[model samples]
Structures are given as structure tokens and as C-alpha cells.
Target: MEYTELKVWKETRLLVNNVYDVTKAFPKDETYGLTSQIRRCVVSIPSNIAEGCGRRTPKDSIHFFHISRGSLYELETQLYLALDQNYIQEKEHKVLLDQIIGCKKLLNGFINYYKTLKTKQTINH
Candidate 1:
């Protein structure tokens, strides 16, 4: 399946875009610190999903999804830090946080479904 066709991938892409847009307005002093960390974590969301999808096994896909989840948490933490540092307003922070949470839900759903499929295949075989 194409990466674009996956709901989790699509949502993750959107979330990453949102993070980029918000981080663009971050304070100039944060160029090498919070900004960099936040960008990397945001990028990891879709990157992991694509990497997992390219793998030969469902277990690999699930592993990448788990990694993506860890990145999502990292992004969330950075977002909160940005808010606390006054880099982003509460409203913008909340919106981005909501998107992150949504993407996480989608990723978890995909992981669960993939695991279920793997289990069924094992049982049938």
C-alpha cells in the first residue's frame, strides 16, 4: 500500500506540517536547541511509519510504529516546553497537541490491527 493511502501516515504528515509551521515562529535564540529537537521529533512521525511500511514483516511494521509513538511523546513534551517558554501561545499549543494525540491514536490502531493480522496468520498456519 502507498504511504499516502494510510490514514496514520496522512495524519502524521499533517501533524509534522503543523509542527513546522508553528516552530517557524519560534524565537531566534532557539534555532539550535528546542527548535531542532522539536523538528526532529515531528519528522520522525512519518519517517518511522514509512520505514515500517517498507519492512518485509508485520512485526517490523509494529516495531517502527512503536518507535513512532516514542517520537510522538517526545514531540508532545517539546510542544509543552515551547508553550512554557512562551514560544507558542496556549491556543496554538493545544491545537498541535490535539493533532499529535490524534496521530498517536491512529498509529496505535494500525499497530493493533497489524498484530491481530499477524496472530491470525500464525494460528491459521
Candidate 2:
């Protein structure tokens, strides 16, 4: 299946764009600091998912999914830091947090699905 068709991937793709839009207003001093870090994590979420989908085995796919999930968590922490630094308002933080939470749920579900496939493959062999 195409990674683009996955809900987790679609959600993460939206997140990346949203983050980029929000980060544009960040202080110029952070252009290569927090801003760059945040953007990288956001991009990794969907990029890793696409890479995972291209893997030849469910196990390999899951490794990438875990990496994607890790990036999601990392992004969450960065968003909180943005809030602490006043780079984003509470409302903006909440919106981004909500999106990240939703993506986490979808990504966890996707990972579980892949784990099941790996288990089934092992059982059948």
C-alpha cells in the first residue's frame, strides 16, 4: 500500500505544513536553532513513514515506523518548548498539541498493525 494512503502519513504531512506556517513567525535568531530542529522533526514523521512503506519486510517497516513515532514525540516536546519561549500562544500550542496527539494515535495503530503482520508471517513459516 502507498504511504500516502495511510491516515498517519496524511496527518503528519498536514502537521509539517502547519508547523512550517507557524514557525515562520518565530524570532529571527532561532532561524537555525529551534525552528530548524522543529521543522526537521515534523518532516521526519511523514518521510520515515514513506520509507517504512517501501521496506521489503514488515519488521523493517516497523523499525521505520518506530522512528517516525519517535520523531512525533520529539516534535511534541519542541512545541512545548516553543510555548515556554513565547514563540507560540497557548491556543496555538493546544492546536498543534492536539494534532500531534491525533497523529500519535494513528501511528501507534499503524505500528501495531505491522507488528501483527510480522507475527503472522513468522507463524506461517
Candidate 3:
């Protein structure tokens, strides 16, 4: 399946777009610091998903999914830092954080399902 057609990838792409929009209002001083870090983490989400889908094995796909989840956590941390530093307001922080959490949950579900399918195939074989 095309990565773009996957529910997890679609939601992740939305999360990344939301992150980009929120970061646009950050202080100019953070351009090289929080801003860059946040962008990279957000980008990693769907990038990892796409890379995983291109792989030859389900194991490789699961590995990339885990990496993407790590990036999701990284983005979540930076988002909280942005809120604590007053770079983002409480409402904005809550909205983006909720989206990040949703993406993580969806990714986790996808990973579990993929792993289960792989295991079942191995057992059958």
C-alpha cells in the first residue's frame, strides 16, 4: 500500500502540518534552536512511515515505525518546551500536543497489527 493511503500516514501528515503552522509564530530568536528541532521531528514522522513502506520486509517496516514513534515523542517534548518558554499559548500547546498523542496511538496500533500479521504468517509457514 502507498504510505499516503495509510491512515497513520495521513494523520501524521496532518500533525506535521499543524506543527509547521504553530512554529511559524515562534520568536525569531528560536529560529536556529527550538524551531529547527521541532521541524525535524515533525518531518521525521511521515518520512519514516514512507521509508518503512518502501522496505522489503515487515521487520524493517516495524523498525521504521518505532523510529517514527521516537520522533513523535521528541516533537511532543519540544512542544511542551515551547509552551513552558511562552513561545506558544496554552490553547495552541494543548491542540498540538493532543494531535501528537493521537498520532502516536495510531502508529502504535499500526505497528502492533503489522507485527501480529508477520507472526501469523511465520507460524503458518
Instruction: List TM-score per model, in order.
Output: 0.95, 0.98, 0.95
lDDT of 3 by residue, 35-118 (tens): 999999899999999998888878888999999999999998988899899999999998988898889899999999889978
Tell me the lDDT of candidate 3. 0.91
RMSD of each: 1.0, 0.6, 1.1
Model 3: weakest 10-residue lDDT segment is: 116-125
Task: Report lDDT per candidate.
Answer: 0.91, 0.95, 0.91
Q: What's model 3's TM-score? A: 0.95
**Deviating ranges (above 4 Å) for candidate 1:** none
lDDT, residue 94, candidate 1: 92
Worst 10 residues of 2 by lDDT: 1-10
The list of candidate 3 runs beyond 4 A from truth reads none
lDDT of 1: 0.91
